[model samples]
Target: MFSTALQSLSSHLPGCASSGGTSLKANLKHITVTLATWDAVWEVYLDPKWARQQLRLYGAQDRAMEQFFKKLKKEISELSMKRHGRAKQRVLFVGAAGIGTRGDWGGDAVLWACCK
Candidate 1:
């Protein structure tokens, strides 16, 4: 199911060209998945576009990121049922004002160094 959602994202957002001569479609690292045991974890990568149009600094618009959130919820709910009870859960939908190519990191205090 998660794979299906990832596939759909590529369709929704046509990629932009990057300096490395690769398109954003080729850099699907935007979405990250990690595994944990005896606990529930669902991390949905928020599209940069969605954040810009629908999200505010201190709040979110109704259904701002609904589609992805719903899919993650459904998957987590199903997995929780198999354990027969509520579990320690961590659901993260992450985005930034401008982390990728949208803007240079100019406002934040955190120095973000990277590898070439």
Candidate 2:
């Protein structure tokens, strides 16, 4: 299940060449998450502010980004399998808010590297 999820994620990323378990990038996009908590279900993509409030109340404040991606990947796979549809849609990653780390894609180099 993890490998399938990783493959699905890799194929959707920009400039990634996947072949039998290579490397991947961890870049993230701005995605809205749908979550149900406390008798209210939220489609948080439309309203960030409301989502934040609800997530905070639901005790997901620390892992909001993780939750977003988890839900997104699952939904993408499910939708594609259920409808026989394509899951290769463009995603917009707004701002540097969700970046896990700082990296350098050298000014004029070929390799991309990130330092932990």
Q: Say which candidate scores most in TM-score.
A: 1
Model 1 whole-model lDDT (C-alpha atoms): 0.45
lDDT of each: 0.45, 0.46
lDDT of 2 at 92: 35
- The sequence of per-residue lDDT tens digits that candidate 1 reaches over residues 8-96 is 76577666522367554444444432233213422223557656654463134223334445666667777887786764354443444
Worst 10 residues of 2 by lDDT: 107-116
| Model 1 vs. true fold: TM | 0.25
Give me the runs in candidate 1 sitting further than 4 Å from their true place: 1-64, 93-116
For residues 1-116, write the lDDT of model 2, one tens digit per residue: 64567668767875665344434333221111222242344344457897677657545533454456556666766887667765554343434333333332222211111110
